[model samples]
Target chain A: MSIDVLLQQIVNGLVVGSVYALVALGYTMVYGILQLINFAHGEIVMIGALAALFVTNALIAVGVPPALALVIAILAAMIICAIVGVSVERIAYRPLRTAPRLAPLITAIGVSIFLQQIAILVFGRNYFTFPEIIPKTPMQFGAVIVTPNEIVIFVTSLLLMAGLLFLVNKTKIGTAMRATAEDQKVAGLMGIDINKIIAFTFAIGSGLGAVAGVMVASNYGQAHYFMGFMLGLKAFTAAVMGGIGNLWGAMVGGLILGLVENVGLMFVRGDYKDIFAFVVLVLVLIFRPQGLIGEKVAERA
Target chain B: MSALLENKRNQIIAFVALGIFLLILPFLAGMIGQAWVRILNITLLYVMLALGLNVVVGVAGLLDLGYVAFYAVGAYTWALLASNHFDLSYPFWVLLPLGAFLAALAGLMLGAPVLKLRGDYLAIVTLGFGEIIRILMNNLDKVSLPGSDTVYNLTNGPRGVTGIDGLNFFGFKVRQGIEVFGHQVTGLQLYYFVFLAIAILSVWMVYNLQHSRLGRAWQALREDEIAAKAMGINVRNVKLAAFAFGALTGGLAGGLFAAMQGFVSPESFGLLESVMILAMVVLGGMGHIPGVILGAVLLAAMPEVIRYVADENVQQKVFGLVVIAPEVLRNLIFSLAMILIMLYRPRGLWPSPDRKADTGGSAK
Candidate 1:
């Protein structure tokens, strides 16, 4: 393979990996706190994409500048998706908090299916392309070419990750989240509102997922109802590969999965790109079930 | 004494009535168009698939998102053996057992590694395994078959294998479009074959498995893995058995499907098929054999029924607006039903009475 082609693939993988990381964080965080795999996380990403699409279209119709409209659209999408995330936890998950693990898991699947169906119903099944706000001109760096869209996706994803890390490590709410994840009962005894912390966690995770969705939709130039399904599965794999409750682990897992998938396509066909990531996940689980960086967080009795 | 006798009599009568209805279903469809019969056959195939999945997800307490992988393995095995591609000709009866065996082997291989994992981790790994198999099948065209570089096409790639021979029994061919009783009975015959397969398997295999010591062990594992393991259950062996059993059923369904369709493709066994089967298990009440059958029939027939209703333009528009317009609403409703059931009846509809009593504490 030529250097240029390899470089291009690497760049593509990075962009894709960054989005995977962003989505994986959602899974990791939710899993960390509630010990619940939020299957609906991917649907939240879809909702974000649709929400942004709607807002941008409305803004353009009302004669707003494309750039400003894009900004507003992204913001609106994030906020809306965050609220949906919090509401999902409160309504669907909370009641089943004391129920068996299977109940919540099944409910999460139901929520995911429900969200996808709703997206299809509202948007129709056809792919919706985000209006190009950023110029599509490719920048040449030696023999490697980079597009503005790719640059935007990478930078935005990193910023979001950094912000999340800071939120989790630096803020009081973050401490509460960590505490709740560690031991809900102890965290409650320490005067943390377990419910509120959980809601906040969902909001943060949802916001990140929304940003990833917008970035992905913009890069791909198309969004569809079932888009989140495979992406969700991939992100979940990323989360597990990196360690379920570990945030940075999810990031590493996502990047590794993306690179393996993209690079593996050199040997395997592109149709098997998805298969490569899944293979990595299975192998990783077999070898390191705790994940690459997963810490053992005891389940609350 | 009189009441007890009446109840026993009613139970036997109900069972006999159900049997009669099943026996006459093919004839009823033959009177109509064979399309309905074909659909019924597909529904039975789904029931088999759902029942197999139930063994893993419902009874063994393992969440497998890629149950369709076994179905693929079974179908492909039969397709390769029966098709002229490999020039290996096998009788349909022989290939059926071979398919199930291969599928079970695949299941055992997959199950062995992940026996130690639980919940979401197991789910994700299985999901990956499913995708890997699918990708391999898609790219099998490029991979040379054993001992042949003629671009040995095993799966026939995306176009899939066609011209698969139908099942023959003792010099009698069960071809589609044959006439019986002054009515054409090609598709109806296939339907009856599938129906009989499902009924026989459910009674002879699945039901028997449910009551066996092995079945109790699976349920124990599902209820509490640690407890079951502590109670002297060989968790790994039991779990592997569940996987193999599930795959066996899937393989049987796949073989029947190949015979019925006269073709098989990788596309037919995608992630969506897995989800649909899981939906059947969930919607019908997991762990309940009868409930799963009902779920499979309802979900399998749903799209076709929707298509039938939306056949007319005016009706299509109205249906689209009310029920189908928001694809999410139907999904949401379906999921909502699951959630509601989980909230109200976590044990699922028709949960084993013994299990119900055991989980009474957690049910609160």
Candidate 2:
């Protein structure tokens, strides 16, 4: 409604957009390499957030300092999720590599549902409050206000993206990943272990998703067993918007989606805010299926 | 005379026996428990839905993940016209055809958008469309009119529309039982017969459609879209037809569901329902009518069977301990079944005999 309100919404969007970007990376990387949607990636994020909550609560109760407990929880979550991401690929996806296109997709959906059920069994059906370890002190910047958590979420996401870019562009493993994405058979012919590279890609993407999960939980101040379902859909929408399989596109798509959704909610009821990303997704598919940064390639015959 | 003739005669006898058994099932199950009859009714509805989806996914290889949206359309159509919500009531014949037509239009709308997209992209877009429909249903309760201060309650919001009128034909209401040969029949039993007749009609129609020229076109498209286009098949029209026909069945089923329950809500047409219907078509043997029906019946009955066997009383008596919740177990099994079946039985449990040598109907 006002300048300050618009600025505040923009700030809110940036923080959440960073998280969406992180999750989008997971979807993008998987899509890039395997040509799979990785429908279960959102469940990995949920698992990360809940695992962090569990660890943090336990550590804090045992007289550990809140700051240290948060760090430990974040690391533990990343590792747990990396293992989960890799294992899901091995068990559910590997056998169906040569199967029909719809086979793996259906299996992915199954994996998603299975993970959610497992989460429900472990965490029960209630929402867990994320511990307020980080200080939420608001800082004034002219007409706009921002919180310390918002800055942390944004900075952490940027650094992770930079690190990932460096890995893909500079490191040998990153080169192998890119080659694999370019052509799996050629990469294998070049003596690159395709399976291992694919597993590594999943690990890296899921680890970053873990950080995003924590950021989301810390930002929202609560975590639920099935919170990732809608979040996953929205993040995947971001991946598509940015031109699925493109890392930079994922980052750009996530931020744009978040900004549009947050700013658009100002005029409409908040209850319908979730519809914005999907509406964007449909419009994008109809108008520009390849996405903003995606190169226009001929459709495979 | 010939071995083939003898086999045909035995098959005829077997089919007659099975048909008689299904006809008497409602009364027999009613004597045992009313709940079983309700489960069977719902299963039949699912069979119709699965068959409808089979036209799109199994036959045409479209892989629609939001097939439930059309079901919602059909259900809401019945709810609005047959319920007291708008102070209107339509006859069964009028509502069913109207609902089916509306759903077919929706299918066309959905089909048009994703005509260029393929595989997972189409799947995701359809899924988003389905979610959009559900969200609209959930939030369309108090919509404000443009350039005016009038607020209208269309769907009645999350609470949903209740008190829907049952199917009425020639002054005979399904909600009220009819007498036959001096025997008192229950309302549910009568509804069961109606649903059975409709489901049979659907199966018969779908079976005929599968062997028709249009059916062959759909199959060719499913196997290779590019090739199908090259072979003089109207790809766009065939795809749209598959969606429309599939949606027609889903809509008819949804309208019937509303009549049976006398209630309709956004919750009934969620993504899980769509996935479950897809699972039924895939698990049964995509493109095979008998297999699809079998998959639908098994899956629809699975949860009910779980609830029965895992009832706390049954669990305590049988196992002497309740280690896990029955609902959670049901969902776990449901999810696992999807993954495992896809992994091992990629062509489904009862794949088409002709498709045995081919890949899963996809040309790379």
Candidate 3:
């Protein structure tokens, strides 16, 4: 491909990667504390997109400005998905916390199916048009071109990532979270309400995922109930690529996965695009199971 | 009756009754509809699949989310070799052994890489591997060389390999129903017997394996890997054996499935199929033969039963109208059952007697 095409792919990859990073944070944070995969996390992203789609469309119909409507819809989606993420954990995961590994894993799969079915019951089984609320004007930089939506997605994702870092690093709750993740019993002894910290982690992570969901819907120009499964798998792969429990690892992993997948599309048919993330996942697990930025954590016996 | 059934007589009576029941199943099911016989055949096939997965995840304690990949391997092998896909139509006897062998080899290959990975990590890797296999099956239809005009067509892409040859013994085609003593035997009934026989063979084979010396090694390994190593068990070999054995069983089932269906496609071997099989194993009672069979039958027949029950009589009379389709309702019920069972009956619907005694039958 030509230089412009390569640059365009890179730009596309960065946009997609940011979304992956945003979702990966949810997985990494939950895994850091609970060591659970949260298979339904992707559905949270889907809910965010569909919820945003519905809210935005309704708001636009009622004479709300498109830009303002988008903002409100995203906030609403974040709140709704935060509730969903927390409730899933509370209902499906909490009871099985001390159960066998197989139990929790199976339940996670069940919860994922449950959410997807619920989504289908509420929203019909077809794709809903995600209106372009933002300007779609193309911005040309030398030989390369990028859309305004892409720039917004990338910038918003970066800002959210930065804000998350700030919250986890500079805030007291962040310190508590780190302590809880390090040793839940010890943190509990230290007067850190372990459950609350865990809930906060889910909330913050899911809210970020909501923004990512909106970005994904905006990028694709449509939203569907089943859209979350593949995207969730890819984001999970990204989380593993970076390092499961590390926030920075998830960010780097998502971008790398995104860039590689988009750039690799030049050499293969688009039908094979989903395979790239999975291939990367298997290779990474086989070669460097700790991931790029992950510390070697011992498996809990 | 209870006093009459004593000792060896009880075993003999049970065996004879089971045999008679199986013999009459096609006819009994045919009384309702031939479609029910087909469903029963599919259920028996799932019994084999669940029994195979039981060896891996249930007995060996290795979570393989890609177990269906082996089934795909066997199905595709049969599809390619026994179908007119490439104009090579191999006999069922040759295809069966070959499919099982290839699937076993794939299991070994898959086992080698993730031998050190534990639990969820192994699960994710296997899941990825399964997806890779599926994507390859979906996209390998037309593979063009870079900067070359030559293209290779394999797997026929997503449309799948169709019109596969059915099972034929010598000159007898199983698909072509036969008559005996002026009685008509439908092809579906023939397939039912074939599946039932295969299921019985598999269950017997797996039952023997579960009690073998190697089986003890697997159980030891599952309980405690380090302790098993200390006990002089060859952990690596035992794990590989589980993988290979399970894959072999899955392959056998897959080949039979392809022959019966006369078609094989990528859609049939998705992750959902793997999860479904795992559910059967878990729901029945992991590492328990009879329980696994029960689970397989219940889950495999569930959707069809739902479809039958949700017909116009129930949909219009009971619910007033069909708000949700039977397909969606099946999934909803299936998912809800999974969550609820894992929550309350974590040991499954029927826990093994030994495990029950060991844990005092506690849910935990």
Candidate 4:
């Protein structure tokens, strides 16, 4: 491989990784709070991506500027998916909160399929051309050539992640979130509204996931209803890899997952791209079940 | 009759009624349409698959999200060994056990490494394993020699292996068209009987196992793994048995599926199928054979029923959107059903018979 070739792969990996990190944050946040694996998080991304695709196309058709259209598209998707995320919690998950472990998880799968079907209904089954809002020119940096969209994906994901970090660390709501995640009853006793905190967590996490969906669609240049499955699985793997409940760990895990998957592309075929994240997940769960950055806890009996 | 239903006689009567209903089903299906027969065939397949999976998910209480991996293994085993792809025309009788054996082996292999992991961790690993198998299947068609241009073909990739042998017994081949009892029995109707037999066998086996020592051990494990282990239940062996036996049962479904479809593709075994089957177990009461059968039939048949009613040819419209595409609503209905069921009846539509007592025990 040439110098530029390796750099290009790294750039592609980082771009994809940033989106994976964003999606991972959703999975990690929900998992942290409820010890629930939000299986539909990927579908939220799909819905967001599809919504963005439709809105951007519609806006451009109505003669809106590409940049402004993109902004409106992202915002609409975030709002819709945030509602979707919260609705999923209130309708499917909350009722089964005290139920057996399997109930909510299976319900999550149901919600996933439900969301995908809604996407299919709104947008047809096949891939749609995502409107090219970003300029189509590639920027040359030494031997590496990066596209404008890649920079957008990387910068947007980082800024959002940094914002989230600040929200969780500096804000009172973040402290409440941390407290509830630690112990809901104790947090409730401390005058934190557990329901409100959990709902807020879902909204914020889902909004981030929607943004990732838009980024990934722009990066790939196409949006499909079915695109959520593989990405969702990969993001879930990334969440596990970063330590399930740890926020920053999800970001680190996403970047590493992207790099590893892309770096292995030379040896493996493209179809094997989705397999890399899963393989890492199985290995991490087996050897270091707590994850790379996750603080170890006593095994649940 | 009440007395009969009150004891073993009740089981016999229920079985007889079920037997009669099932026996007349194909004819009724034939009267309705060939498509109906196909639906029954698919439903029976789901029933067997759900039962096989019940051993792992329901009894053992290990939430295996990737149960379809065993189903794929079983299907492929029959596809490769019995199909013309390898020029090996083995009979279905010989291939069935072989297919199931391969799946059981896979289950054991999977069980060995991840059985120690618990809760969501175990669930994620198994899910990953399922995806890995699928990706490998999709990508493992050609292997280029390191420095040479030579390529080795394993599976045919996406196009899939076709022209596989159909179900046969000794020399009596059950092909697409055959006559039996003056009615022209389509191959589908014949397969329905075959599936019914398999479903019964799986039910019988599961029912017996559910009451056996091993079954109690599984029940114990599911209730409290640490307590079971402390009580000398041999958690590892029990867990492995649940995984292996579950795979073996699922393999039967897969083997017959290959024979029925006459083609095997990775697409047939996807994450959706696994989740659908899992939904059947969850929706029907877990660990309850009869309830699972109910779930299997409903889920498998409902989509086809909706497709019929919501046909674009009709004037049906939802929200004035023409309802032209039923695919959109099919998943929506199932998922909606799942969410509603979980919300309203988290113990499932039909709670296990003994679990009725379990609720009070846990409470007290």
Say which candidate scores most in TM-score: 2
Global Cα RMSD, each model: 3.5, 2.3, 2.8, 2.8
Error of 2 at A75 (Å): 0.8
Q: Is candidate 2 or candidate 3 better by TM-score?
A: 2
* Interface C-alpha RMSD, model 4: 3.6
Q: Write the per-residue lDDT of candidate 1 for residues A1-301, one digit (tens) a residue.
A: 8877888788878889999999999999999888788989999999999889889999999999998999999999999999999998987899878765666776787788777776776777888888888877899998878899889888888988998899999998889999999888899999999999999999989998998888888888888887788888888899999998899999998888787887787777677778778777878888887888987533221
Best by DockQ, which number?
2
Model 2 residue runs over 4 Å out of place are B1-6, B181-183, B356-364
Residues A112-166 of candidate 3 have per-residue lDDT tens digits of: 8988989999887999999997877888999878888989899999999999999
Over B1-364, each residue of candidate 1 has an lDDT whose tens digit, in order, gives 4465479878788779888998788778766777877887888889889899988887777888889998888788778887776776678779889989988998999999998787778888888788878878877876665677677565778888887766766666676556668866674565576567665666468888988999999988887777888999999999999999998888878887887777887899887788779778866667778777777877788766655654455445775545443334444555676667667765555455444532212222
How much does candidate 1 score in TM-score? Answer: 0.90
Candidate 4's TM-score = 0.94
Query: Candidate 4: where is the Cα deviation over 4 Å?
Result: A2-4, A60-64, A299-301, B1-12, B144-149, B176-181, B316-321, B356-364
How do the residues A1-301 of candidate 2 rate in per-residue lDDT, one tens digit apiece? 9988899899888888889999999999999988888989999999999999999999999999999999999999999999999999999998988775666777898999889889988888889999988878899999888888889989999999999999999999999999999988989999999999999999998899889999999998999889888889889888888888899999998998889789888988887887777887888888876776876645431
TM-score of chain B of each: 0.86, 0.95, 0.94, 0.92
- Each model's lDDT comes to 0.81, 0.88, 0.87, 0.85
Better of 1 and 2 by DockQ: 2
User: What TM-score does chain B of candidate 4 reach?
Assistant: 0.92
Give candidate 3 regions above 4 Å deviation: B1-12, B356-364
| lDDT tens per residue, model 3, B219-294 | 8777777788999999889999999999999998889989999999899999889988988888788888888898
CA displacement after TM-score superposition, residue B322 of candidate 4 (Å)? 3.6
